[model samples]
Target: MALLLTFGSYSALDGGSRPLEGNALDGAVHEAGFDHARVGEAWWVLLPVVRNRSGADVEVLDVRVLDLPAGLRAERYAAFDAEETGAPFLMVRDGGPEFPSGRYADRSGRPVRLEPGEVSRVYPAVKVRVTGEVLGEPSACRFTYARGADRFTQVLPCGFTLRLAA
Candidate 1:
C-alpha cells in the first residue's frame, strides 16, 4: 500500500476585489512539529508539501507567508521534489544537509512545474529576533498557480512553529 501524508488542508482564495478580512486565516493551524530558533540566527523550516491534485499540469507562480507575528520574517528559499528528499527538515544555515542534489529548484525566477499527482516540498528560510520568550500564533502560506488558462490561489497553514530563544 502507498503511504499518504496529509498535514494541512487547502482552500481556494480566488476571485475577490475586496481585501481579505483580518481573521480570514484564524482557524487554520500548523500541526506538523515545532522547533526552537536562536535569536539573531536564521533557520530554514520545511513547509507542508504542495501536491498538484488538479487534473492538469500546474505552474506554481509564487508562495508567500501570511499573518506572521512581529519579529519573524519568512521568505521562500527553494523547493524540491518530495519523493526524493527525506526529513529532519530544519536547516541551520545556507547549503545545509536538507539540500537536495539535482532535485532542487528555485521558485522565484521561474514558476515551478507540477504535473498531476506530483508533490513539491517548499522551504522557507526565516529569521527571528525578539525579546519575547515564545511565539504561539499560527501563520499561513498562500500559493498561487496557473493551470491551463486559469489562475488559482490556495492557502494552507505552515507545518512547524518556532519558539524564539536568545
Candidate 2:
C-alpha cells in the first residue's frame, strides 16, 4: 500500500492563476506510509507522477523537484524495479535538474511529450534528503516541468510530509 501527499495544486506563482491552456500538466508525489518517515533521516522516498489534464497534448521537457526545503537535497531516478523477494523499489540517485541561469531556454536534456490524457511512468525514483535543518514538521516538494513555452510547478499538499521521530 502507498500513501500519497498533495500539498495543493497550484500554477507557477508568477502566472497569477492564469488558466492552464492545453490541459496543462499537473502532478503528485507518491510516498510510502507517512509514519515510516522521521525527522533527521537523510532520505525520503518520492515517486513523481505527471498527468496531461487539458484538451490538447502537453510537452514535458523534464520533470524534477524544485523549491525543496533548505538543508534538503533532491535526487532523481529514471525507473523503479522489483526483486523476487524484496518489495517493489526504486534505485535512488543523487541530484535533480541543474540548468544554467535558471532560464527555461537553457534546458538541454531530452524532453518528454505527453499527449492529452497520458501519465508519465514512475521510475528512477526520486528521493529527498534532509542535509541540514529542523524538519520535524512536513516539508514541501515543488514538482516543476517545462511544456511548450511555459514552465509549470505544482506542489501537492501533504503530498510529501516529514514526521518527527517518536
Candidate 3:
C-alpha cells in the first residue's frame, strides 16, 4: 500500500496567474507506526507534489523548508525518469536559506509549471547525524511555499526522534 503524503486540491490566484492559491497546497509526513527512540538513523525527506487541476497551464515556484534545527543534516533529490514514479531518487542539492530555488525549480531556473492533471515531485533528504551532541528529539518542522509575494506554509511530521547512539 502506498502512503498519500499530500492531497493538494488545486485553485488559481489572481485570475490564474499562480498555480497554488493561498493554502491550496497542503502537506503531511505519511510515515505511520514509527517511533523515534527505537530508531537508529533518520532522514527528514521532503517531496513535492504539484497537481494542476485548472484548465490552463500554471507554473509554480518550488516549495521551501525553513527553520530547521542546526544539528540535523539535509540533502535533495531531483526527478530522473520522465514518468513521475517518485523513485530512483538521488542526492542533488543541500539545505539552507540561500538555495530556496534549488529544490523545486526546473532546468530553466524558473518555477516548474504543469499542465492539467500533471504532477511533479521535488525531493529533499534531511539526515539526522549526531557527532557529539544529539538533536535531542524531533519536533514539528515548519516549511513554507511561496509564489511571488504570496506564501503558503505546511508542517511535516518528523519521522524519527534524534538521540545519542547507544
**Candidate 1 clashing pairs?**
none
Q: What digit string (tens of lDDT, one per residue) describes model 3 on residues 19-89?
A: 33343333335342223322333333434344544454444433433444555544432322234323523
lDDT of 1 by residue, 90-141 (tens): 4333344544333454334456565656664533333233334445654676
Error of 2 at 119 (Å): 1.4
- lDDT string, candidate 2, 1-166, tens digits: 1111112223443564442322254555455434343444544354455566665545443334444556556643233222321333322222223211222221224355556666644322345655555354333434444444455545433335444345
Query: Pairing residues by index, what is the TM-score of model 1?
Result: 0.60
- Candidate 1 vs. truth: CA RMSD? 7.6
Candidate 1 yields a Cα-based lDDT of: 0.46
Candidate 2 vs. true structure, TM-score: 0.47
Which whole-number lDDT from 0 to 100 does residue 87 have in model 3?
Answer: 56
RMSD of each candidate relative to the true structure: 7.6, 9.8, 9.1
lDDT comparing candidate 2 with the true structure: 0.41
What is the Cα-based lDDT of residue 142 in candidate 2? 43
- Largest lDDT belongs to which candidate? 1
Question: Candidate 2: minimum summed lDDT over ten consecutive residues — where?
Answer: 99-108
